[model samples]
Target: MDPQTDSQAADGGRVLIDHAHEGHFGARLRAAREARGYTIEACGQALRLPVRLIRQLEAGEYGGIDYQVYLSGYLTKYGRHVGVDEEAIQAELARLAPRQRQPDLVVTGGVSHSRYLLERYVTAATYVVLTAIIVVPMVWLGVRGTLDRDMPRLAPLDASPVAQQDAPATSSTSAAAVASATQPQAATPAETRPEDQQPVLASMAMFPPLDHSAARTPLATSAAAPAAAATGQGGHELTLNLPSASWVEVTDATGQRLEYGILPAGTQKSYHSDSTLDVRIGNAGGAQATLDGQAVQLDGFRRANVARFRVDIRDGKAAPVSY
Candidate 1:
């Protein structure tokens, strides 16, 4: 038998093998998609399907997918987009169908062995576009603000320090006479204390009672509002607190990536952002967030589930915003 004809089919219920076509039927569909000027990413975007799924359908690699019904839909969409008639592809998939029995209704599975689609979303091109849209205004404000703060102020030319330093070095005689006049006269013997009679105070008398309030630092940082609330005139303060392990990524409205790492238990970090704060958590149940000081509720979020939130920071700490 030809090697291609003897090729193996996926084990899962996801795909059916059509030994009759020799598994090379994908060649035509691949050519058609390319002819339409759609790359894998563009095709996935336009079809609202994942790239891995498309690749699998093309290569007949369905061992990773868990759902048969979804595969049917993929086949349907793939045929429609590439001008493959429904009848022909259906016959092929039908010949490749799982043996023994089939379900009346197929439900999409929650997980997949293939993680390509997950990684795809992580590096989506949309993120770059979104970052550009958010950063332009922040860059303008930051530059303008820096210039205003650093601009030099001019002083009168006549008041230059050079003029003061050049004042004819006063005659030495006059300077000595002025110094003598400003100095204290030597004390007479009667007016001076004896060498052994220096004034002294008991240890208790040395220091007055301490006033705790008076010694506080004038520039110390303090909470701006009640612990449960925070106010922002231009933006918001974002904080992420992890009571358990979680992977997180954060980007400020200015498109600056603040952090992206796996946070261990008991880890907490804070940031201030203008406009929006973009966050991604690999384990939503293990992560908690706050806007300003107001707590964000993540009660419904599940473990091992990824969640993305885009918070628009506005004036004041409004109700916890989520995407």
Candidate 2:
């Protein structure tokens, strides 16, 4: 019999062969090979097959060959040429192969092309579903881990030193001397003594009480009002009275700027608030103001809103301020 006539027909009881699909597969294989600019001989070299065998396979007339085995290798080789998934193409070929009582005598009417079409579709959908199932959870886990890692640490606030304004100053120097003392010296490390050593107090000095005749006034007593609650947030505003130009920045509770600008001399800048403020009176030549009417004693650090002694910023430097 002529090899062409022996092949299954597209219709009738010849066999359940899909001529159109077979042709499409052949066209794709041919296009894939040619797209790489490879001739049939070059393709055969890659597959370790003769050029005649490759040409017969592309013509869809390799009846003498094991169609399943031959197509599997052919699809794999062609796939590499075009970067398509070889397994997916092999699966398509397996689904298209005729199934029957005997491979040689496949009965056409008993097979359903529609069933194979559905099977191919289901296989593709399963791959898509499996990919989504695997990838989505990984993405969610990455985001959740980032959020867990980024949460801010607040433990330091509870451990900070407290600043109590009502506490008496440790030094008895005049307020003028205190104001002039711009920097507080850090206390020397405490000297360790023997267990039997007794502590000693330093010598004391006293000044006579000021004469009240010049400023004598009737002693009036009024009950003090209850203290205001702390806002638990600290920030400051500065108004600069400069002879020339001066710029200053006031930071908020978190040491971030709440306001910043420039002003001229004798400009009564009022920065009055019941909050912890970070003031930077920058580039001013010998300037001063009444911080709540008591001279602006540019001394010791102020703590942050959350802590007692952590100053966020100072006159010209940054320090932790605590309340």
Candidate 3:
């Protein structure tokens, strides 16, 4: 092929020609550098670029440069320094660089697929089944336990035939004693005999007649008594007053639990016991106590905000005993 000359504007607006046989940009750049009698090192020094970078640029090896913009800038500087046209350098760079193809976009509605919906339904069903497996037996056991706890137990019946046969005889003897007690003048002359009177007296002593009139007296007396007197069978009474939330437990000497659990603010409660009473107060600073209507100071007995003491009946009076 005949040597081709590519003419391009250079530095100082001068025109230059590449006399290389091959019309490639790298060969033309090398030819231009030779025409200007400039070595790669001298050209790099003049353009403030590395010698290796100038060689790569002249050889059209642009892979060492990261971005196209940087490569374009370096090429423009190097070409202008060596009397090569910037437009020609840019055109050569565009031809050598790989083209970037934009991906095609497919638009769709924002609805979920049937398979995804089915998967979600299956997951929900699995969760429900798992929950039922865990919760159903627990609920059944709780209900069964509640039924067992609430169900009343019946007392065993007396099935002995001798006891059943004797019940009527005992009732008849009681009726006879009641009749004799109601009418003392209904005795016959034979019953008035000393020997006969003794058996009747023994029977009356064995089966006492039920007096319905005297039964009302005890009920009337209990109703007339104070409410405290009814619950406090033991002569001693203990009163507790709470100004704030606290826990109190009271037990009598008989090991009977009189009061227990958390008491709300402004709560007043009383307990009665015949013997010594055990008392425990949680949050002692908030509680006030009285034994037999006498104030019992809880502050001295308090330790770690808890007060534990005992109320003892001494000399017919209630007094606090602390530990």
Clashes of each: 2, 21, 0
Which candidate has the top score in lDDT? 3
Candidate 3 lDDT by residue in tens digits, 1-323: 31221233223433333324123766778889999999988888888899999888767666677776677678778777877887777665554344323458999867569978999999999999999999999999999887766544321111122122333444656778677668877744434332221111011011123353453233233322322322456677788887754556677777886654444445677786778888887667768988878899898888767788988677787788784
**Reference-based TM-score, model 3:** 0.33
**What are the RMSD figures for all models against the true structure?**
35.8, 25.3, 19.1
Candidate 2 per-residue lDDT, tens place, 1-323, comes to: 32223444324435455455555556666777777788987777776778877776566554646656666666566666655566646644654556312547766676589998999999999999999999999999999877656543211100001111111343476784466455344221111211122212111112123343221111100001112222133243233344432333455555655434433323345553334566654333444534433454333331221111222344643333334
Instruction: At residue 249, give the lDDT of candidate 2.
Output: 47
Error of 3 at 244 (Å): 39
Every model's TM-score = 0.26, 0.24, 0.33
Clashes of 1: 2
Candidate 3 backbone overlaps, count: 0
Question: Model 3, 172: alpha-carbon shift in Å?
Answer: 4.3
Candidate closest to the true structure, highest TM-score: 3
